[model samples]
Target: MGANLILVANDEVASDPLQQKLMKATAESSGAEIRFFSLEKTIQIIGRAADRQKIFIVVKTPKDVKVLVDGGVPIDEINVGNMHFAPGKKELTKKVYVDQSDKDDLHYLKTKGINVYIQDVPGDHKTEINF
Candidate 1:
């Protein structure tokens, strides 16, 4: 997306002090303006940034995309990478994991006209995701 701003929207960092520290460290090392914000504030930030920046939002779940689109962010596509394994979740690829909620969220996004795909990294083969 040629994004100039990297917004990390994972709420898990709020509770995990180590994760927050690591995130900050990553930003410092990469020299990227990585902002930690909730999805609600993310919308306002994006609106304010639209005219002056390109944003790449990093989120943990498909629900995050749904929330952004529902709240009026123009997200037309999503590329999923590695995901943590959770109880009751099935592994789709070595890196992709999903539970029923994830499935439903992805289906919802698909119905809303978003192109969903799984590719762990750029230049890797992308598998088109279908509900």
Candidate 2:
């Protein structure tokens, strides 16, 4: 996979030392530029990278994706990443969890012709999800 640039969620590089180190190595080796931006700025960044290949946006929850789609980010297929367990959340995959609200967000995405799936990380088995 050719990674040209990586846009990390704001302040994450400092808070997540391990991830920061990993991404730093990746950036150094792959010549990928890493920019830290707020969630609110994702749409603008994505808009600029629209013509680029293999753009990946990672968010904390399903609602974030719903917000992006609602705000007009044209996401067609989204793979749910590691969602830590919480009381009202249902486990879709061992690493992925969702509450009813999360399910509603997914359903909304599906209604918009956006495919959804479960894949906690790269190289993991991907499972298509339908509501």
Candidate 3:
């Protein structure tokens, strides 16, 4: 595949050695070429090359997707992975939890014509984040 793996995060996340290591490990395990970018930089770079590059964006939260979209990044699809379910948050799936904020952000993304899928693994059947 000619796709590139782009991990999007803020400065705090990009500065963490453990986070960087984990992302690198995951990328290597998946045989993807990985690059890190802050939210703003992600918008800038993806805005420039989204049409030409098969870029997979890994974001920390749904809010990040909203930020990118609000900033004019052309996001046609998004995958919400690693959503750790905890008590009190409504369990959407074994690996996904949602509160009001998550629901709101997801709704916003859907209304903007972005397809959002939530799963630790692709193709797992469950409730979809459809509008």
The TM-score of candidate 1 is 0.86
Lowest lDDT block of 10, candidate 2: 5-14
Query: Using Cα atoms with residue i matched to residue i, what is each candidate's TM-score against the true structure?
Result: 0.86, 0.74, 0.82
TM-score, predicted candidate 3 vs. hidden true structure: 0.82
The sequence of per-residue lDDT tens digits that candidate 1 reaches over residues 2-121 is 666678876675457787678778767555676777778777667677567777778888888889889898887899877779899898888899999899998999898988999887
In model 3, the runs with Cα more than 4 Å from the true position are 50-52
- Candidate 1: list runs displaced more than 4 Å: 12-18, 29-31, 50-52
Candidate No. with top TM-score: 1
lDDT of each: 0.80, 0.74, 0.74
- Order of the predicted models by TM-score, top scorer first: 1, 3, 2
Which residue pairs show collisions in model 2? none
What lDDT is reached at residue 95 by model 1? Answer: 85
Residue lDDT tens for model 3, 1-131: 35665554565666677888787887887666777778888777765675556777767788888998998877888777677776667877667787788889999999988778865555565356753
* Best-matching candidate per lDDT: 1
Q: What overall lDDT, based on C-alpha atoms, would model 1 receive against the true structure?
A: 0.80
